[model samples]
Target: MRGGDLVVRVLKYLVSVAFLALPLAAQADELQEAPAPDAAAPVPSSSDTILVTATRLAIPVDQVPASLTVLDKPAIDRAQDIGVTELLLRTPGISISRNGGYGTTTALRIRGAESEQTVVVIDGVKLNDPSASSGGYNFANLLAGDASRIEVLRGPQSILWGSQAIGGVVNVVTALPAKTLEGSFDVEAGSHETVSARAAIGGKTGPLAWRLGGQAFTTDGISALAPAFGGKEADGYINRNVSGRAVIELAPGISADLRGYYASSQTEIDASTADSLEYSLNREFVGYAGINLDLLDGRFRNRIGYTYTDTDRDNFNPTRARAQTFDAAGHNRRLEYQGAFAIAEGWTLLAGAENERSRFRSASPPAALATPVPAPVRGGADITSFYGQLSAQPIGGLTLNAGLRHDDHDRFGGKWLFAAGGVLNLPTGTVLRASYGEGFKAPTLYQLFSEYGVASLAPERAKGWEAGAEQHLFDDKLVFGATWFQRKTRDQIIFNSCAATSTDALCFVPGNATTRRQGYYANVSRAEAHGIEAAAALKLGSFQLDGNYSWTVAEDRSPGANFGKWLPRRPRDTANGSVSYAWPFGLTTGAAIRWSGKTFDNAANTTVLDAYTLVDLRAEYALSPSLRLIGRVENLFDETYSTAIRYNALGRVFYAGLRGRF
Candidate 1:
């Protein structure tokens, strides 16, 4: 049978299974609807910190059955990182590859999963661009500014998030207003003629709270390509961003929220060689409106929201006399409802429904020839999904979570996903956790109906499992954790060369194309990724030490000639360590080191990137009660490293800044 026929059969079976399980789930839910009874409070063995992404509800971070990390404002400030990429690089089980310096394409891989497989949420808005070659968020222009916190959830998380969550989820929460009226400003000057300025004002008055912030940054960066690649000119980048948020109490137990963000950038990049002059202008926008209601005297909580996102990119090759160029835009609109109810003592049920519509358009302007611009490729798709999760603490020191989701896509019919996990508190500050999850990614519009598109392709699928243990010592001041995880993916999409007789719907050669290759997207057989992550943290007096190490083996296990080969751009080993001290005299100092082992740049492992290590230092001093001075040196050793072949990495650089609040 053909691939299309097989997909239809599997989809039918999946649909039947999903329907069969719903009644059983409904019955189970009914049993939990008994009268609420007071249950004995469970003893807390883990930290009290909370994370919202683990189950779409606030819960203790350490109690989560999967490995995760949280970075608060203080931690982010002390890190002294300029961009999101730098901030996430210190995290365990994460690796990064940048084509050039700031503002260039930067890709992140978590636990051996590809960049596009990870989901990014900024203030409740998804940032993935459906029009891009690979459907993922571009981290190049995402400068860190006024962020309250960041949460990284590793492993599959499709039960809460809809799609493209095979790797994990990264949630960025922007700063919000405090109870007291306060405002702050920051200005910085650095190497490479870089300059940055940021300011924010926020306050809470009565039952209303509001915050407004803006940031501007510019830099004359290093050549994107190495000297050998004919790069002799420096690329420059500039970014401007503004955001606002407001929340108002509507009733005794109700609240309303409104938020919006806008960011734009103009970046110069090298195309093919250093001699080429290419530039791109990109803009992003996100808007959200939501309402929250509390019922049953706080026993049940519900939130309904609407989100809209727009991403646009325009690229120009100025070197060409005619300034050849192309532009694309993508829009995503979503409506969602979430509810968390205390079904019974020691048990909570979380459920939600999401309806999303995505649209894309792309066009290439006519060149020097007196020709007309071609019509844009336009397409749209919709996905309707319903999901539910149950968290139970039937006994002391034990927690269990189970979730399921059913998604109905306009083009591909329906599919179901499942995830389950548990955490057990052991004796004397020890905890054990285990989790298993399944994920799926629907085909993007460009892959489904555009040129070289395949409408018959099925969604890519993944299954992941992890187990870990943690120990707390010294009155919970010091902690250590170790986790092992593995994931397997099937039916990955890849482009293949096609011949004249090819009957595939996606195979085609345009009249204006330069190459003779006609290609189409096809499903690759299989791949596997497994890894070990270990972390430790110690706090003594005014000093703190933190470190982590990861060993990843991402291989192409497909049934083909490249089987058993190393996956491109995934390093076998990565490690990070940091130490900091705060003096009684309002002075703080920190130092950190990051290292990455060798990695392959190609599927066949022919091209390689050697291992390299970098050292960074940061210091801060309180000049006054509400004033501070900060300085940092990145790449102290000026080590030469290549995350991507022939791409130059930033060397030793210095930066100094001042911040004040009123």
Candidate 2:
């Protein structure tokens, strides 16, 4: 069938679904909010609601001594974006640089920290890939379809998350089942032959609550590089994902829960030249099971969980037919136990223990036939950890928090980390908060056992502090917040130059260390980053306005050729804002703007990346109580720009879709 015909058929089907929900509109008046449902998720009594990620315990946002942002289901629906990174760009202190448009290599930097320094968690499983040289979570193929809530904590959290939390943490939670049977489906088609479809079913039955979801997406993406720079062909991408969760009550105060997610994608890539047709296949799986027990009449809670994660990746040159160019697989297993107890009327204690093992294997063909073929490489590591935290309300309108952790690695022995913080409330809805924390990151398998790996490297360390103030006015209708943070890192690892004249100890040639230099990973640098983040919001009746700005100064303080230079792909200034209004007729219209300042593509600042501004417009109409029509015009101004050197960004695009629930 022709592309035009396919789009027409999809449009008709979606319209029919929307109309089917019209009959449900007549019963809308019978709907009522449910009672206390999910633990760690308390019903909101006011705008300043409570969240669980900040402390691993339910606490009000204004009372937590940390900088955090929560993007709930309603906020996500307003954006109407398919990719997770697209929505994250509107968050404060978050920046991204992707090599191309959709399904490309994307990196996220939080609060002037490197992309690899942040941590990402879904459900109870950490998303970092052990096989990756940088040991970071890739955001390229992460879609927003199954995510019901996302919590961003911006600061060092090693005391609670163990490793790779020097920058911060991102926690994604899936939607839970409602009391009654409910299901939803959405379909969208847009520019570049792009099409996306998603469906979900969820409800509670007797002692069980469950949700199942699936999504399919495809797009003929733009070139990875500009035509002027030799890009000649458009890369394409396809993704399929499935997610599920279930909870069953064993008895009156005991429950068991399970969660799983799987995703697979094939993304076209560019080689040295523009005409190359290379593609990569990626598969990721995460699953976990846990049992929760509430004792002492709900004053004490305990959880025991086990998690498993696996990943497989391959890159191939389709022109070469059956020849496999590269292949890799990684697996991780973890067991954990946590407990929370109310020690006193105004104090609570939190503690947890974890054990994890990670393994990886990889194989790659040589670049030339004459080059000797290398055998497959294998590596593994084990880690054990214990952590404790105390939260106290020692005085009126004041809260104090302190936490500590100890980690023992199979190779590196042991390390200790800690964090201390407090929040003070003043007259008329004013809050003051401050926190200090230390973090550490262990070497990845690729860094210690790969072909050019170095096993003698030590773990990198960091120290950081932040102070912030928030003011609420007009009964929480208007809010203003600002935070200032600074961080210093020691023994940062980086690939060193391999020039013959270089004196770096870690850059020695294989089997001829005394004569020549060869590139290798080493921990030989110190760096510093400082930034200011500010946010404002106004809500009055049916209109809402929100904005956030970040001023970051990220420099390499190492004593070398790149000393005191700006970090790559990090702009000095960035801001995001949106103005939205809802009509009584069940129609909502909104506009959003994202602005980024100039950035560099190299440590020497030789390749300058032009700044850009993007504007998007969205509208939604409720066709019935259970159906909604959504439309979005992205890149409304058609601004030509690039987040990375040589890459071509997207142009103007339009998308229309409908969502229906029953």
What lDDT tens digits, residue by residue, belong to model 1 across residues 397-468? 888999999998989899999999999887688989999999998878877756666778889899999999
Clashing pairs in 1: none
**Residues forming the 10-long window of minimal summed lDDT in candidate 2:** 31-40
Tens-digit lDDT track of model 2 for 203-248 = 9998998999999999998887766679868989999999998989
How high a TM-score does candidate 2 get?
A: 0.91
Against the true structure, what is every candidate's RMSD? 6.4, 11.6
**Which regions of candidate 1 deviate over 4 angstroms?**
1-48, 498-506, 509-517
**Per-candidate clash tally:** 0, 0
Give the whole-model CA lDDT for all candidates, comma-separated.
0.82, 0.82
Please give the lDDT score at residue 302 for candidate 1: 65
